[model samples]
Target: MKPKILDRAIVGASLLGILISTYALNVEMAIQAKPEYKAFCDIAEYLSCSKVLSSEFAKGFGLLPNESALKIPNCIYGIIFYCLCIFLSSFDKLNVIRALFGLALCTIPMCLYLAYLLAFVLHDFCVVCVSTYIINGVLTFLIYKKMKVLSAKKTC
Candidate 1:
């Protein structure tokens, strides 16, 4: 496989993830600003971005709660993660590929955990969140495939 092709795939997936995360962050902000705010992502009672975004977990793990001025939305991390992936993809170094692979590998478990929380604990689904998870999965797969190709090339 061509490295350029893999780079494009990674960049494309990262950009899509960024867009989805941005939308989720906006919905989260709206929910915080107005208690009565209903986001379009609130498709149904069981499938509501508002419910998930408003939950305690949405603030993510940090020293300060989301109510604190220093706190940031969890989606902000997604945006940064995807952006970093995109940035890393610009380089053709094996180290860059390894970094991307490591980042993607780390994200898979987090996505799985969040998916479990949505399905069981939260009992609510955020379409935007799910979409981002799917994107992350795809990104990981692409990175793995790219890594395999790079390894093969290095061996040969």
Candidate 2:
């Protein structure tokens, strides 16, 4: 496959994982459910998905926990990231500029949440959740680079 195609495929796969991870997060939220995958939550007494999701940070610093935040779940962000991958792959077709911006826009909270997980709260790490975060971070960078390269090609 072409590099862009390959990148998009990777992003698509990452999104699917993100979707599953989001469901796991939801399960964490709704019950004392255990994550099927290894995670930061499985690490310690304070550092669990159940703890993290229900933490004040997960609750949006105590602002919009129950409403809009729920709609914008982690998996949905994965979907959005995948959509950006699709758009980026077709940059010779869609709004590459807006999509790049949107991808960065969507990731801010994820980066923050992931940051909090790694830095402050979780004494242990969940490998799958970390993988998801790493995927998103990489996708964001790849999409940005892809957009820049495409724009240059168009000008050329």
Candidate 3:
């Protein structure tokens, strides 16, 4: 695909990620404020976004303890990541594109671990979580395409 097209796709995917993450953050806050609150994505017991979001693994990227200084909501991390991606996508430098590609690629392992938790530990499906994963995948692919296009340009 063309570099311009890939850039647009990356920006679009990153924007979507931002929106989803923001919504997830809002929902999380609402749930915290009122435990009885029902989110729009709370469809059923097993297929509930709230259930998954409220899970212990949803915080700190499931990597840090609640008391850890680095621990924060996963949605916040998503927001930061997508914003960085959008910022990085504005550059045409090969190194910048490579960095963006690397950043997007790094999300895959987190996605896999979250998927495992959703399926095995949490036993719940989160629409918002899954949507973010898909957005990450899209961003990764688009960034990769952009990297290849930039690399080709540099070689020529």
Candidates in order have lDDT scores of 0.85, 0.56, 0.89
Error of 1 at 19 (Å): 0.4
TM-score-superior candidate, 1 or 2: 1
Q: Which has the greatest TM-score?
A: 3
lDDT of 3 by residue, 27-78 (tens): 8899899988899999888889888887788799788977898788899999
Give a tens-digit lDDT track for model 2, residues 29-137.
Answer: 5654543434434566544555455445444433464666454445455555666565555554336544664765577676766666656665445444566667666
Can you list the residue pairs that collide in candidate 1? none
Q: How many clashes does each candidate structure show, in the order listed?
A: 0, 4, 0
The C-alpha local distance difference test score for the whole of candidate 2 amounts to: 0.56
Best by lDDT: 3
Predicted candidate 1: what Cα RMSD to the true structure? 2.2
lDDT of 3 at 152: 95
Better of 1 and 3 by TM-score: 3
What TM-score goes with each of the models?
0.90, 0.61, 0.97
